[model samples]
Target: MIWETLVEPFAAYGFMRRALVGCIAVSLGATPIGVFLLLRRMSLTGDAMAHAILPGAAVGYLIAGLSLTAMTVGGLIAGMAVALFSGFVSRVTPLREDASLAAFYLISLAAGVLIVSIRGSNVDLMHVLFGTVLALDDAALILLCVVASITVIAVALLFRPLVLECADPQFLRTVSGLSAVTHFTFLALAVLNLVGGFHAFGTLMIVGIMILPAAAARFWSVSVGGMIVVAAHIAVSASVAGLLFSYHHSLPSGPAIILAAGVAYALSLVIGPVGGLARQIPSRPRTQL
Candidate 1:
């Protein structure tokens, strides 16, 4: 009975299969980026960048009327611009990258909202904000797969420099010119994954799939590689479970997935192997001899 409930949806419905594939692609691509963001203490930066893509998507909507290709291109351009501009500003001014990102994203979010409202209906805006995972078509699936593949390959190529940059940026800067390379490359990957994620989970929720699973995985593993592996597993599991739950309960698919991830993060906070609440409780010291 449990197996039937869990397995029958994908078997019975083509949309279910497509949704699963899309979610898995996002998990594979986005969670690794999330891990690096977490290590660098830049989870909020990921969120900022996610918002930064909205104006581009809104512009694409305005130009082409919800065409995925246009929206994707717009999002990529917008996200990368924020990243580059933020980097440039930090170098030239007293403002730090985080503050620059925050300011840019706020402006972007306001601009996107205004743009979408000018020509779009509430429903259209909702779709951009929250996502439409169950409605993914062939083009969306293909885009997701391509993005995930590229992200995996790029991360593999940049892995060593990325680690060094995160661990010891001053040392990496002194030794190699690759700090900027790794930073912008990772930012590019983040944009790509977020654009793909917007298709599956929308702009609002995509960051959850990216950061939540990675954050949860932190409670389970100590190594970067292990954290990434665990994060992927957690993300996949959450996607599957969330989809099933949504099917059974008639909930919105995107929020259901994020809610599932939220649940996992909460559980990890309580009982996870690393710095969980339970683990942090100091046990009575052993009596001295």
Candidate 2:
């Protein structure tokens, strides 16, 4: 029975399989990074970096003529450069991290729009903004696999330093030297995942998938490891369910997946018994009323 449903769809159409696999791969790559981003209070940076890749993707499409490999590389490079430059500017100047991030994203957004306008038509712009998951080919799949593996390995190896930096940057810096490299590496991995997910979910909604599930998982778990595990599971489940829903209903998979993640986030915000909004609300109400 399971084979019957999957066989017809998976065998009949390669795009379906690619989309499914790519979604799952992105979740695995992104969820842990999201956890650290939240812990470090850089949640907004994730959103900013995701958007910052748009121009790079557009430029890649223009130069390489719509090749996914080129687009992914372009996005990765652009994201890393943005991360480095923002950090440098913030460190050297009086501007805060948030200010630096805002500048970076605005510049990238304008550049992306201008470049796409000059080099390609509206269809190319649509593909960059809305994405083309159904258009993914073998090369993109291979790139996703490589990126996912690197993300997993990077997370496993740097988990301790990353956590220390996120939870207590001052203490970590004082005791074990500045964890700047680890922090940058973490951001780089996150940007790569965002690029990959851009192809799956587009720039506008990638942050919803990257941060929402991880944020939701935090409400359910006190331990960081537990949160990471739960977040990854939530992301994978949402992706699979969203894909199935999109296939049956003829909806766009990216938005469907993001909505599913948003639901999970909402559920976590309200329903988790310990530290959830439900628990916090009643105590405050009892005091006031």
lDDT of 2 by residue, 135-207 (tens): 7777777777777899999899998898888888889888886488888788889898889878767777788
For model 1, which pairs clash?
none
lDDT of 1 by residue, 13-78 (tens): 999999999999999999999999999998988998899899999999999988999999999999
Where does candidate 1 stray beyond 4 Å? 283-289
Assess candidate 2 and give its TM-score to the true structure.
0.91
lDDT of each: 0.91, 0.84
What's the CA RMSD of model 1 in angstroms?
Answer: 2.0
RMSD of each: 2.0, 2.5
Instruction: Provide the lDDT at 5 for model 2.
Output: 51
What TM-score does each of the candidates earn? Answer: 0.95, 0.91
